[model samples]
Target: MHTRRPFRTLALALGTAGLLISGCSSGSSSSGAASPAQAASVSPSPVPAALKSYYAQHLSWRDCGVSGFQCTTMKAPLDYAKPDGGEIKLAVSRKKATGPGKRIGSLLVNPGGPGGSAIGYLQGYAAIGYPAQVRARYDMVAIDPRGVARSEPVECLTGPQMDVYTQVDQTPDDDAEVTKLSGAFKKFATGCEKRSGEVLPHVSTEETARDMDMLRALLGDEHLNYVGASYGTFLGATYAELFPGRTGRLVLDGAMDPSLSSIELNRDQTAGFETAFQSFAQDCVRKSDCPLGTTSADEAATRLKKLFTELDAKPIPTGESRDLGESLATTGVIAAMYDESAWPQLREALTAADAGDGSGLLALADSYYEREPSGEYANLMYANAAVNCLDLPPAFATPQDVTKALPSFEKASPVFGEGFAWAALNCAYWPVPATGTAHRIEAEGAAPIVVVGTTRDPATPYHWAESLADQLSSGTLLTYEGDGHTAYGRGSDCIDTAINTYLLEGTPPPADKKCS
Candidate 1:
């Protein structure tokens, strides 16, 4: 369900909330003071019964665009437990198959980021990027989740407030700075409640997964056929758990393991960034554009760290009042970690930054933040925080927990540990109660499910693929010994062929499929 675009748009440079971390603390739910009676009735159900009727009414589609595409809306109960209560609208789009043969069904595609816009993916990529033959036989579809774009989105800070938030130091120098950083996170959280309170509590991934089933029913598909990338893998796997019997051909790439808590997720992700940095370092040593010293990767890392520190103290002016500083620079580097293809561009940016020109690096940071030249933000970051905060509670409950866990994160990536951990602090003061927990998904009754892993994937670690494969009753592990986030469309002919064969026919690849 995710696409790892090599180059980012201005706003995408900030992050894709595709993974979680562990060891962060927690607090009481933030859903606010419900009466005891109302609270008592609010139990998490295994499956909401109201979803069936909701699905039935939502399947009808109307004209969307070009000849084949259709658009519609699906309604989900604001709270799954109160299914017949207030509802939320989810926007749906589909491109019907141009088939000369029997149609398979709807194949839902998600482009990673628990918050990424499925509608955007459908319009921009899935409409054309999917294999033509597959497009010919099955309807390709997308649905923007509850608090994502097109759906009722969650907005926290305004443009000016966000500019300030983006500039918050990810790595604090001492107790005073840590308090300042925590205050920023609290402000963002409070802003969400103040600006978008109504929809904030309903954006959990579990809720989204249930919404997907409603989409499946409306589409009249007997089973759910899906291809999920990055965080999309998590959503698909969750669906398999809830509706194993209704699970069809499912593919999860850049896999995330449900068994791992937030801390573990963050630590592993930090290590992944390290792996990617090492790969970049190795390649940079052989390239003329390399910015860091060529003595060794260690020297390169040290030099980069020094540069980051220097920028932290005296940020380079990018002509704009909002210029590239150390925190944004660090974020920009981490964004490149998502795809190895961006290495050359990263090298260029680093070289420019080293030469006292911060525009290149600033541009990269702007892309991550999805910031436009005028300083407005795309809905990406807002939706990301909404979905993430709703899906899982805070990774760390308090600043003290972050301080205690710093060493472990530092061990993961000496350069990025502190920043990532601080970023995890955003959910601490979430407006809604966290509805899900870290649990393994067996997806026991499903048909054969293919799990693909890119060995050096910075977003989702390779070990997670192995873990998920081992956990699933009918999971098959497919390995791509390459550098990148996901493997299928990144030029591994073997990988493409294997998945294509599986989707076109009913056969999976060889059990031990490997692509180098």
Candidate 2:
């Protein structure tokens, strides 16, 4: 279980993780070392005999305050190696099938924040918005991973503390600014250690993957049928690697390669965001109201870069205690890169920011942070760092390392690269050492899994999907020749039809299948 982890103070931008290329590219990442012993294998160690009770545990479900949904709590060992030492409870939710057709069991959904609340995703969007045919045939299910919302969430900074963290200058110009940013990182890590002391080490993606398996067995499913997006893809793939024989109908949209080192992950994601911005810029320039200007994409990029520089010099007002600084502004832009649907709002936000009213961009930044009107934030960022820091070693152990990587990062995206390089340093100050390493995951004997990729996906690059498909022995590549993060359920009938067919009928699309 591995993926990208950006600056928490900036809402985990630049997509997630460094990934394995073809043939489990033998590469070492900031994630410790690429040891074969740590690498995921087709033959995973069997369930420990001591953990029989966990496998046999029962779920007591009842109305969870939400209409048409049932909620339950699940118990699993906090540390797998010490099953009896302690246990953690995971939050689970499900909406039973509408049932106009034959039931096809539970369809687990995870919208990949790594720290994202799968339960929230299920209730908020997936339960109501999925295709009627699919919803009617399957019970929509989700389990908020440990240390995520509704679970034993990981807490770091308070709302006010986080507010200050968010405005930290990502593109530092002077030694003082760099030291200030480093101090902020240290504060955040120290806070999490003080606040979420117990669960930090156990929140790795691998742990969440095991949690998913526990859910699968508790639900009485012989095989896991899951739709995982972004970092969720890494979780799903890890499950397949750990329990290949029990995996079924896995759809990994916006997939993450399990083999990425921290440096590769951050660099690749920076480039990925650049690709997404290029698409947005091209589209924005076609309209007269383009915020960056109705000019060539290159010129638009130059203008956006200039704006970032200007914001770094002096943040504009957002009519709030916190101003729209470069960090927040960049986060706002990166948030829109995840979905084309948000592009219009991004354009409008940029238009407003350019005119000295930073409110719109600030609002966009708030959305990225999942900030509520009351100023409280969701646990997404805290868990993101908790899991990511545990999943891979820091990309750079010192600020000097980041300075060394700056040239390469800048080459990736001149507009966003410098900030991203600095942002990558966030994990360096993690309270605990990384428990995981950059390794390959090949679910050798698993059922054919559908891997979906959006060509211009800003966060999880299309190449990642390609590499993931190639990594899994029984993988099928389903390409959506379009933009955005994930392809399915994004208005592409061709992509959705293929996924729906696989979920409903268990027949994956043909090799080299392409959708627009």
Candidate 3:
């Protein structure tokens, strides 16, 4: 779910919730404590005088066009190590409790993007879609992390350039095709360096965790109460690791394990998508209108791969200028796997694409890119790559690396393996080295942290939640025995009640609780 392209859009479905719903500290200061190198570390020292100015600076809130939502901006150090070096502005938004009870405090919500706009999520979903009791007692809040939307966003390719990049053949048959794919990756990285090099180095989840603490202090919350989905779960975990004592009522839905290397993460995610796709195929075959043959899931998968091959050989024409090539078609299929609700759309898109009309699949791919009808795009994909590339080393350092690893990737996912392996190459061309490495996050001394996982979550795998929960000292695992990218506010009343109880009553559900 946390991949660079279509995976980044996992938060989109969760973000449309008004209708639906919505690290480490510095190191070396404590003996026997997990070092920064071992986890998403946070600074242990008290706020420095220079940084105190930023932490204490007052925000000027104003109407952000969303009724009942007040927005403001906060300043954070571009480099946390150098508090006085330079500053970055983070966009913050809040909707006060509509209460029939005493206000508890601010409940900060982030829809995982690493690149997703928390402020946009706050105003659009969390403000109105959360449970009434929880909303009545908590100030719903969100902050667009630095380099995300409304913040000083990271920008890379223009719409046209992105279209070309997205359409590039991913499953290359030979060295020339591989080179072309590599060139596309290089182009994307080069664009980021040219447009957002300065902010690129500082957009790691570790930096964003520190920013969250500052927002926490500014909002006067003694403890940080939060709900983070997908990549946001990683952010929440990082914050807990950094400020364990400050963690309160945290719910990490669609959790990610920070301990996996880039290759491992990519492999696991590829397998996850395969798992989700299998589930989709099983359901699809049962439906009469399944485009990928109406036999077994395995047969459907074969048909799907055949479609990719066919598109690779001969791109389907969309009414729009963009045609449905292998890459775009794959992305469209991947997009639908994020949520089951989109399955119908995927089926329709596939049916149309098979009929030589590619508009449906192209539209789905565009939605995955957060592309506007006018061909403009949001900063989602740009920021996704920026943060992902900076946070960890590239999954593959070269095309040869991808070539060598192709078999294992293919074993993990026969349908998506080649493309994902190639897509993982994007970070290889990054202008900067990774700022943080993968490590276990125990978040020692933290309060009970609820980690929620959907069994069939395509983006963030269920086992990841288990791994993360096991790593956190106070982590509790809550399983939703169902499908989707996230569990909370997604129509599982059981999941919702458990999360709401923890948020409002400061009591986590049973450590091994499972909700169907």
Candidate 4:
């Protein structure tokens, strides 16, 4: 039930224009060698004989149901280590560039769900809402990663089962509650193994990055040009590492540091969400209708925590089958922390929750889970756990480990720490062994890669962006001293111009260049 922070906010926040101002700049920062633009050879590494067909396959792009967009499918090895063992089809989509400017190449984008549909992202916003100049010169492309939406999505529990899973108390107050939470995790793991055991081991970020290279070749591009946000940044970074020579114009927004272990990531993210909430608290106290309090940020946070305490005692009715409990209310708050524009909504939701109407908070939690009106949930949470559990070892191996980590997590964020710490236990019961380990991604020979960070980002915190930029040999750091998840296209003309210039001109912004 921990959202490892979906990068979907890139589209969710940017999708609404009137809600953003987009200013990002930071004070002192550090970066690695900022190399000038390195030409991307159309000729990437020679295709291995095993992958020749996958590389040479033609995409039969046709009108997707969505206007101005085309969709196609491409084949990839289900188990990349064992190519030809079997094939899984990946869904791809594109919007061809308009005129008035020469086409640069295909600009691939991922909104980061590990489960977020890149194809959906392209159609929903990237294809049409991106800067016109950039769109004019590039074919906006997206490939739903192997187990994500549009592709053969990894299935787990049914709608009713997921409902039970989401409502399971994350912050266990006693042994019985703890046992219940642990049982839920085991059941989820068993369900996923029963249904998607085959694909679970194959959905690692490393595999998805390889899939991108395949899509790159099929698109007839010499090098890959991409914009990845949140978890997408990790995917892009992995690609750059795996195929440094073929990386071109990569913009890793809201970058993630691959060096952190699962424990480190979860703890840091705990602190990050707290940081974002603090920012929200400060802003909230300035408004007259602030539910927590207008007295002060500290008081507001205290009040919210007190509300969570009350909800733990008795859940509030949402006018639906589901009620607003501590777990869902926490999720609702975390969802709003992704974008500042949602702060007002969070305040209103909290106000309503305080008044015994939990509908608003439930709605927010539903959106976070990608729950449909039909009561079915998107594969988002399922695939999120799939990719995360496979990409790194479980954050905690047992309930005892969670108990040991609670104090440290609480120190990170007193409000969310306990629940977040317990949430990390969700993956401990995974059926598959993790295939990836936490390590630095140097991508030494890649072209100048742009790494963006938001100072108060709730997920994929600013420090992760700084760490990534420092790790990559040719990374250029672009700091956004602002709130929200990803920076580009969110309204910072500075952020947009810098990234667009990099994508269009192959010239990254100067290292440590803060956005304004």
Compared with the true structure, the alpha-carbon lDDT of candidate 4 equals 0.84
Across 1-516, the per-residue lDDT of candidate 1 in tens digits comes to 011121222122233322111222222211111111101112223434556677557345666544446676678889888887799988887777777766777789887676677777766666677788888777888898888767887887788888888888888898898889889878888888897898887887888888898777667666778888878888889988877777778888888888877667777887877888888788887776689977688878898999999999988877678777888788778767767777888898899888777887777777676677888776677777777666665688998898889899888888777777777777787768787788899977777788999898877889989999888887888999988787766778899888878777756788868998
What lDDT does each candidate get?
0.75, 0.82, 0.82, 0.84
Candidate with maximal lDDT: 4
User: Model 3 scores what on Cα lDDT?
Assistant: 0.82
Residues 316-388, candidate 3: write the lDDT tens digits. Answer: 8999888889989998888888888899988999999889999988887877777778887778888988989
What is the TM-score of candidate 3? 0.93
RMSD of each: 9.3, 8.8, 6.5, 7.1
Per-residue lDDT tens digits for candidate 2, residues 1-516, read 012632211222222111101122122211111111112234444667988899888777766766677777799999997888899998887888898987777889988877877776777678887899999988888988999887899999999999999999888888999999999999999999999999998998888899888787777666788999888889899989888877878999888878889889988999998998999999999999998888799999999988888998889999988888888988888877777878888899999999998998888778777777788888878898888889888999899999999999999998888888998898899989999999888788888899988898877888988999999998899999988878888788999999999898888999879999
User: Which segments of model 3 are wrong by more than 4 Å?
Assistant: 1-45
Instruction: Tell me the deviation in Å of residue 228 in model 4.
Output: 0.3
Q: Rank the candidates by lDDT, best first.
A: 4, 3, 2, 1
Instruction: Quote the positional error of residue 188 for candidate 1 in Å.
Output: 0.5
- Predicted candidate 4 versus true structure: per-residue lDDT over 114-218, tens digit per residue: 788777777777888899998888888888898887688899999999999999999998999999999999999899999988888899999999999888777
